[model samples]
Target: MRLQQVLSLVRKAADDYEMIQDNDKIAVGISGGKDSLTLLHALNGLRRFYPKHFELHAVTVDLGFENLNLEEIKALCESLDVEYSVIHTDIAKIVFEERKESNPCSLCAKMRKGALNDAIKQAGYNKVAYAHHKDDVVETMLLSLIFEGRLHTFNPVTHLDRTGLTVIRPLIYMNEADVIGFVNKHQIPVVKSPCPMDGHTKREYIKNLLKQLNYENPGVKERMFTAIQNGNMKGWPVL
Candidate 1:
């Protein structure tokens, strides 16, 4: 997708959800992936014309993996003139070496989020922007139903009372395909995930299932997304 299209969706989400306040400092959680990098660019461009002026801060929580380089991400941030911070952690060693749990995604996510939020809190950022797109929202709801016997997904705006940071997904209206197109069109450098369990998680399984279902029965995914929006799930805005 072009930058204009990306910005249009972003602006809609921010406006509808009241995500950006004047003088707000938002830390974009950069995972060195396409989704996060795309979010980084979209928010960076918003600084130019967004009515409610806000500053952008970019951060990556390094998992202490071997040969994990972030110089490209740093360069991209520099090109966009966004402030970047890299918080180095020993999560890799702890998860794979020490704990060695069969299901590492859950633990890894908790650890990563903890680290990311710590950085955001320390920097006095009141909000953090995640790159969860429409596909992720659907996939998560499916995961919740199939595993936990529940119908649920994250919302566009979530406030963490304890951390004093509100979570916002400005790309909530964006599809995963749009994100892939944006990254390819912009030549965004995405760092390959070096985790040993990259594609061996329940999420990966659900993602593949969604892709197959979409291929066989067109509009199934969209229908599911619509259901979630109207399902009256906690955290969703009244539609």
Candidate 2:
């Protein structure tokens, strides 16, 4: 996917969900992965012409891993002229060294989010942009149903009354394949995840399951996404 394609999808989702407001200072959560990097790039470009005139700040929570280098990401943010902030935390040591829990993804994710969100709030950003895509939405719903016994998924836009920080997922209409293509074609700088439990999680299981389901029944992913959009779920945009 090219810049034009990425912006097209992002703009559509933003418009559909009423995500960006005029003069909105949105923080982009950069995990240094393809998805988040793609979101940062898309939104950076979107601000150039989008009527809302939002500003972006890139934030990455440094998990205190040995080999997690964020210099390239910092340079990329500079190139985009987006203000960047890195919150240093001992999450890696806390999770793997101190706790050493067998199931650490949940705790690790929560800790990371807490650090990220706090830093975002400190930076005075009223909104945050996550990089969740179409596949993530469908897989999350599947995971909720199969594990938590609930049919649920994230919304394109969400408001946290407590923190006064609204969340927006502008890449909601994009597929992971398109993200990979965009990364490869544009040579986007992607930092590899240093977490030990990177690919061995319940969400990974759901993701693989969705792949098989798509293989057996072509277009199943689209169908599942449409179902979520039409499920009348609170926070979801009307179909």
Candidate 3:
């Protein structure tokens, strides 16, 4: 997708959820993946013309993996004129070597978010942006239903009472395919994940399963997304 198209969807989600406020500073959580990079580009473009002025700051929590690199990401941020920060931590060691948890994604995610949130709070930012898109929403809802026996997904906006930081999902309206298209068209520097279990996770399973289901039953994905929007779930934006 083009930058303009990406900005349109992001703007819609932000406006619908009342995400950005004037003079608000948003910290974009950059995982060095396509989704987060696309979000960075979208929000940077949006602030250029968005009525409610806001600032964008890029952040990444390094899991202390051997192959992880941030030089290119720093260059990208410099080109976009957005400040970037990377929090270094031994999360990989704690989760894999020390704790040796069978299901490491959960613990690793908690640690990563903890580090990210601490950095955001210390920097005095009020809100943080995550790059969860339409496909992620559907996949998460399916995961909850199949595992937890509930029909639920994340909200576009969430307030973390403990950290006193609000989280926003401006890319909630975007599809993963479009995100890939944007990254390819713009030649965005996407750093490959250094984690050992990058593609071997429950979410990856659900992603492929959803793809097959959509192929067999056309429009199922869109229908599911519509259901999420109209499901009247708590914390969902009422448009």
lDDT of 3 by residue, 1-239 (tens): 89999999999999899999999989999999999999999999999999998988999999999899899999999999999999999999999999999999999998999999999999999999999999999999999999999999999999999999999999989999999999999899999999999999999999999999999999899999988998898888558
Superior by lDDT: candidate 2 or candidate 3: 3
lDDT of 2 at 212: 98
Q: Per-residue CA lDDT of candidate 1, range 121-207, in tens? A: 998999999999999999999999999998889999999988989999999889999999999998999999999888888999999
| Candidate 2: residue 102 Cα off by (Å) | 1.9
Clashes of each: 0, 0, 0
lDDT of 1 at 146: 99
lDDT of 2 by residue, 1-239 (tens): 88999999999999988999999999999999999999999999999999988889999989999999999999999999999998999999998999998998888889998888888888789999999999999999999999999989988998888788999999999999999999999998899999888999999999999999999999999999988888798788565
Query: In model 1, what lDDT does residue 235 have?
Result: 84
* lDDT of model 2 at position 190: 96
Decoy 1 TM-score against native:
0.98
lDDT of each: 0.93, 0.93, 0.95
TM-score of each: 0.98, 0.98, 0.99
Predict model 1's lDDT versus the native.
0.93
Clash pairs, candidate 3, are none
Q: Among these predicted structures, which one has the highest lDDT?
A: 3
lDDT minimum window of 10 residues, candidate 1 = 230-239
